[model samples]
Target: MADWQGVSEFVAVAETASFTKAAQRLGTSTAHVSRQVSLLEDRLDTRLLFRTTRRVSLTDEGDTYFQHCRLLLDGLREAESALTQLKESPRGQIKLTAPVTYGEQMIMPIILDFMIQYPDVEIDVDLTNNQLDLIDSGCDFAIRLGRLANSSLVCKRLATRKLIVCGSPTYLATNGTPHTLSELGQHNCLRGQHDYWRFREDGRERNIRISGSLRCNSGIALLDAAKQGSGLIQLPDYYLQTALDEGSVVRVLNNYQDLEEGIWALFPHRRLQPLRVKMLVAFLTDALTNKVL
Candidate 1:
């Protein structure tokens, strides 16, 4: 009650300098305003005002007390203002992670555009194949190609990416095109197919364990191998789209191609999400959906 009534009395009397005027301003009677001010003075155990027939003057202690009251009210107003600004405009650092290959091939261009548009946000981009712990690692968001494995984190799918079983023109011309998946064993293969090659086998699904001359964990390396005619490699559309379009590589098994892999932006639940995280997720979503990259 002191915190509440004291503030009103101080503002009223200070602004009007007359209890009657202050009471009128506060929509209360003059006697009630005088009693509230007396209660405030008693709480502080100090005489705050001296009244004459014509005027009321603040005591020395009252002058100091009023200054502090002004400061407290100003601080509260400033805090509220800052919070309102934060809700309307975003600014801060955001931690983001993504697979190296997909980040470079797809997410990078979008990130570049997002940065340009939102100069206030600083992005900490970590590109790796390993699934990082969002809570422990302090990452705000993650961009994944294919399906996400973490159930705790929520994901929004951006776009479908087609996986292509392709080889360089030189390799196909040299080793000859295999009309059937069975003939794939006959030619040298550079694998990125993620251990299991998805093909329409026996009118159902087939996950074939595959091997290659140069087995690498890096998508770029496998793409390089396929480009140099090292072997036939399987890659998603993001990495091989330009190569396929330029005739650097030719798609094999068009009928056997499977469409399942998708690009996704993942984040934890909303309650604990920071301002920066929300801004980045929105930034990435628009950038990816609109293909601003």
Candidate 2:
């Protein structure tokens, strides 16, 4: 078996570009570091480094080996960190972002409860409609809704939100409810954010272009207009739940409402996440499991 100590010494020398500096960093003698690297090269039957009187440099094979060795060392350190964190309580500030409406109505309450449970934890949340990059924004995690675009970030589904089409009883009584996709085109539709509405027809997904006298980007405004008998509006269950319960708006196209969007907690791609982040995700998953909205 290869000597792990020798491999570590070789990596230190390769990174510092000098055995003397590597020794200084490792708190060992220069000769000892050089000998270890030499032993490492001998074990592999390859010359890993080229040395001159002034400085040291890696050979072609040495460069490739250094890359892999660096990653291996980093992973080892991360594993050790994870183990240490396992023994400690989940305590740290977690910076996260989420969409405005869902964050206010759904996530904020859960987060409040979470803070109460983990007294040592601090949470900083940004509630905005705009999607922010997790790494660039310095957020530990983010809550995202709807279909996510392909990306390198890791995602965990916390819950599901059903899309519902609804209108006020007064409007439905006068204009009639749409039973099929074709009938939807004849009535005024309140568009929100998207130009087309999503539905499922015969097990196939459909995006129908909708038009109306009022087109708004805010879901709350669209819902309000729909409640006042202005036009039919389609929205996620979180936005329409109270209205549905109060009989302010009645759901339409129940048979065709097929698209169910996921509420996801997104984090950076890493082999091991911080324990605090993991704990928060688990807490959210448990809190939201089987939730209707």
Give the winner by TM-score. 2
Report the C-alpha lDDT of model 1 over 1-293, residue by residue, as the tens digit: 44666667765676456887777766889899889898888888898888777887788888788767766766765677557556655667788899887788667887777778777878889998888866445677778777657585778776667777889999989999988888877877776536667777667867766777877777778888898999988777667767777888898988887756667877753224556565566666666656421
Candidate 2: pairs in clash = none
Which residues of candidate 1, in runs, are more than 4 Å off? 1-88, 193-195, 201-203, 270-279, 289-293
Among all candidates shown, the one with the greatest lDDT? 2
**What is the C-alpha local distance difference test score of candidate 2?**
0.86
The residue-by-residue lDDT of candidate 2 on 161-276, one tens digit each, is: 88899999999999998899898888999997788899998899999998898999889999999999999998888888899999999999999987678889988653356787
TM-score of each: 0.64, 0.75
lDDT of each: 0.74, 0.86
